[model samples]
Target: MGRMTDQPARWTQATVYPDMWVDPDDDPRNSEGRAPDGELATLADFLANYRMTLRMKCEGLDAEQLARRSAPPSTMSLLGLVRHLAEAERDWRRWISDGDPLPKLYGARDADFDGAVAEPGEIEAAYEALAREQAATDAALAAHPDLGERLGRDGIAVRELLVHRIEEYARHCGHADLLRERIDGRVGQ
Candidate 1:
């Protein structure tokens, strides 16, 4: 993969994060179009959109390109972001699902981004896995439309879970902005 050098005069807007997760602009749910009738429409909309933004920020890059650290000593890369988000989705789902006891996808805490590499196959697989997890999480959330439903180990409400997911995506999108800028000086929504 070619490293971004000499910033392009005309920067193309990134619709997906380096991992090719989702586009930033389109609706997170129903990115292809608006949500269907009777769908549980609420704060989840924002969260879905935000997650799409994070994915858009990392699109169109190869494995090595996605793995390039934005800054020295940061260990943060687009690929790492994908892996991190995948683990997070899994964790949140587990929390909401009453501890299904499924084996950890990335193994324990902090291991999500520990062994991240720039291999093409790994990059492709990571994004694919992230998409699958995101779909499953969305489905779980959709299954119980009642925002008042209590999920999570601590009795956290489903509404809180949706909000937290949005917060998570928003914070990472901020990181993505800087990472994208460092990669090739591209910026904005």
Candidate 2:
């Protein structure tokens, strides 16, 4: 059977909330308050939410499912997104480092995605790298509370970096949503 046969008879079978990954009541991404009190808090919240969404989208899938490409002519996969985001987070940490920037996690362009093969150790390592990089980046960001102050050799503003981080996560999260839905017909916010 082809890829089409791998899917459910109806896409709706695996969906809830009109194909949502999780019900709103139980979704960890949902928050009760307004967009926080300031620019930094709001941006942080958005980034955090996007990160959680990415994890949720990858939940309950095996190695093969996570690494499966969405379609021909495209190399994108949920596992690739996870690895790519790890690289992105590591870059942010390096960008904000007080001293010399850290070396690239994957050490090659597109390696984050391209190297996301469906292997036992590969999946675990990807998740580990993502978590590690995210924590490091968060710490680096927290150390420089002043969003307007510049960091790194390039002197880019902290606010700009945060916004860029959010943008990257947001874009990949969208890609993840589609990839998950295609894999099993499960979809949602």
Candidate 3:
């Protein structure tokens, strides 16, 4: 098998136990008890798990690693994903709340990814922004438990929004998985 750098070959090239981002015992995404029973609960649980997966994939990496592009032609990076997700969470909150249109967190266009720099402060700020947006979105969603409730100018249902959010996170988390694996030969669920 080929290797990108002198660093040890990826776990895919060798046999490793568990083959996960973290040990099952310490994996926060692992369910310890009864699973969610209702539709909303199930969707929320999925979203939460994906969110944790993103965090876990980015764990143990420094700023440079987090901001490194998957390849020269791509702007994708764990740090950029963090910023993009933060933007998404904010948009979700806005869609549910009544107010003037909120400005973009990173400026217009694909600034979120383009602006993801490998500076310590930028890394901290990206994570902080993501946390803030996630909390705000969660609070807003909590206030509207009725998934059938329609929101935003398009009158999209909350149920649809939740599903869309889950899909978004899932896709991004997959990207995070590959990015993390490339960064450290570490691969897992």
The candidate scoring highest on TM-score is: 3
**Local distance difference test, each candidate:** 0.74, 0.84, 0.86
On lDDT, who's better, 1 or 3? 3
- Separately for all candidates shown, the number of backbone clashes (residues 3 or more apart, or on different chains) is 12, 2, 1
Alpha-carbon runs more than 4 Å astray in model 3: 1-8, 12-16
| RMSD over all Cα atoms, model 1 | 6.1
The runs of at least 3 residues in candidate 1 whose Cα sits more than 4 Å from the true structure, single-residue gaps closed, are 1-40
For candidate 1, the lDDT comes to: 0.74
Winner by TM-score between candidate 3 and candidate 1: 3
Estimate TM-scores for all models. Answer: 0.77, 0.88, 0.89
What's the TM for model 3? 0.89
Q: Compared with the true structure, what per-residue lDDT tens digits does model 1 show for residues 1-189?
A: 979867643254445653333344643445555654542464766776777777767777677778887666677888888888888887788878765655667776656566568898888888897898899888888887888889767787888888888888888888887777677666645
Best model number under lDDT: 3
lDDT of 1 at 14: 44
- Candidate 2 per-residue lDDT, tens place, 1-189, comes to 656566643243233465555566677774655668888989999999999989988888999999998787787899999999988898787676668767877778878777889897999999999999899889878988999999887888999999999999989998987898788877657
lDDT of 3 by residue, 1-189 (tens): 865765545663223434655555566784667889999999999999999889988888899999999987889999999999999999887777667767899998889999999999999999999999999888888878999999877777899889999999999998998888888888858
Order by lDDT, highest first: 3, 2, 1
